[model samples]
Target: MKKLLFGAAPLSSRAADVTWLLFRLHLGLSIAIGAGWSKLVNLTTATEAEKMVGGAGSPPDWFVQQVADLGFTLPSAYFWAVLAVWGEFAGGLLVALGLGTRLAAFQLAVQFLVIAFFWYDKPEPLLGMYYQQLLFWAFVLVTGVGGGRYSADYWIWKRATARLNPPAARAATLPAIPVAG
Candidate 1:
């Protein structure tokens, strides 16, 4: 679990790392700001226009009903709707920051998996499923790769390991070289 949470990026080429970083930034921001921030703010400041699109002060009656339609019992439906909203908002933010990335990506993977497979009566089934599947796979990729060397996980790991094996300690452990006579 610690490894999963704090692992560095794979030891691939610099290009690979850079590419991963770019992908991470794009997907993370898309999920965080594009999809999450609005709904999160809607939790307290949903406008009438927002209401029509499933945003309201409390997870939107329409959204809760949709959750219920997914076979969740009412009240419980409310609970689940709220959880999903929070997950999108917080999970996206964590992913964007590359902090606790694997866990956040895993949660998002589960959410997108459900959205792709379980969402009912999608307006454009193929198109919608494509989008959800793309997101699901992208999140799965992040979960597998973890936060790379450029991520907060790497920074934290470096700090923790440095404390455990400081430079002075390392120098002390090394044998001195013999002088040439």
Candidate 2:
């Protein structure tokens, strides 16, 4: 019974590890290709974005004017738009590579926040902003978990530790042999 249980344990653990790797790959690809790609491809114009933010409507105009009235310089609408696009672009690439996931997620989160802030008057324009936040937080969570089990980080760490401890490496490489009386 013990042998059976022990034999199954490693397989179960390996399956879980593979699942985690798949999750990271899915998340990274979605962020890089689905979300980031769209932004990067459409960063040049802001006419549509400005209209969505209520810039042409009385409610958004009043909101913008109120901020401007307070002596705060209203940011050029395009500035915020471009910032979001580039932040998601670069951050998503970094996260996809597993090189700097935390920093990339942080930048993406901030970009979402900025977009949310500017478009608060037009909830329709900010409909999917929270989803971006959720994705960013998910990335942050995975970053804290240290790049999952089958990552470049794991491979590099294993190689470095093996190089630093040759005796341990040699012991690990030796095959087990059964001794008979």
Candidate 3:
């Protein structure tokens, strides 16, 4: 389980690792703050607004209706709506922190792909689909490459391994010195 969580594939160079870091940061922040935060805030705040105007705050009614229109029907629609909203907000945060990079990236990739193919409509759907497709591919890249060396997963893995074999255990395995007779 630990290995599954922390065993990120090694990068060939420091530059590559840095690039992954930057990409993860931007992608995570964009989803978390730009897309999900307002909806999340509205859900939590329980505002009396009829619909989410200008993308500021989305009341339950509006969000549920949108999810239902997307083919999820009522009751189940509410569950799926909340799931997608949390997936964007919290999953983005986890990706940004590099705590669970692969899992979070995969989730985001699935969510974005769905949005790209299903969410947009006949009016200029091409543009919206193109934009979402880019995000989907970016997330797929992260899922393949993982969090890299500078990620939280690496730091935690390093600490855990160090604890498993302390200095005393290492010294015990060292070769003994021979004294001249």
Candidate 4:
């Protein structure tokens, strides 16, 4: 069983690498534009947002109130919203490009935590937010594992290390030349 699970196998091909890259790109862009970007734009003019859930007539009736309950003060509400939105927007782009992916993922994970906590008062549809939470956890895992073989970071690190140590590259390329009599 162990051998079946951990047996030596050939690495994936370049095509597979490109496919994975495209998958990450699609995932990142969709999450950024569809989910994060709207939040960012809304944060710019969120005073009107207080009307969506309820007006200032009641304290615990609006979305902003929930945010306040989560420890965001009056002015800090805007700041926290902006931070959360930008973290998702910019971090999604970084994850898409596979640049600083781990850091980006970490930021996004924190944003998810904040959003989840703030929304504790009025929970959305389970199918809607559940997948987002799952995605955040996946991002956290990838943050620890890095962007893998399909990432720009991998290639950049390889090139940088190679440039810093030319002898290592040469040694890596050296072949076992057969001696002839």
Provide the TM-score for each candidate, comma-separated: 0.82, 0.53, 0.77, 0.65
Model 2 segments more than 4 A misplaced: 1-12, 43-83, 113-130, 168-181
Question: What is candidate 2's CA lDDT for residue 166?
Answer: 91
Candidate 3, residue 57: how far the Cα is off, in Å: 10
1-181: candidate 2 lDDT, tens digit per residue = 2221111111146677677667767777776655555445432244445433332212233434544543556675444444544565566666555554445656665655544444355444434567655664676565455444465555555566557789877888899888997
Task: Please rank every candidate by lDDT, starting with the best.
Answer: 3, 1, 4, 2
Model 3 / residue 52 / CA error / Å:
14
Superposed Cα deviation of residue 176, candidate 1 (Å): 4.2
Q: Write the per-residue lDDT of candidate 4 for residues 17-99, one digit (tens) a residue.
A: 67667766876787676556645444334365544453212222244455566777867775665566566677888788877
**Comparing candidate 2 with candidate 3, which one achieves the higher lDDT?**
3
Candidate 1 residue pairs in clash (backbone atoms < 3 Å)? none
Tell me how candidate 1 scores on lDDT.
0.79
Candidate 3, poorest ten consecutive residues by summed lDDT: 50-59
Q: lDDT of each model, Cα atoms only? A: 0.79, 0.53, 0.80, 0.62
Model 1 C-alpha lDDT per residue in residues 1-181, reported as the tens digit of each score = 7767886755488788777778888898888755666665554344535443554335657777888999999979999888887787788878877899999999999988888878766545467578888999999989988888778888887888888899999999999999999
RMSD in angstroms between candidate 1 and the native structure over all alpha carbons? 4.1
Clash counts for all predictions? 0, 0, 0, 0
Task: Identify the runs in model 1 with alpha carbons over 4 angstroms from their true place.
Answer: 43-57, 121-128
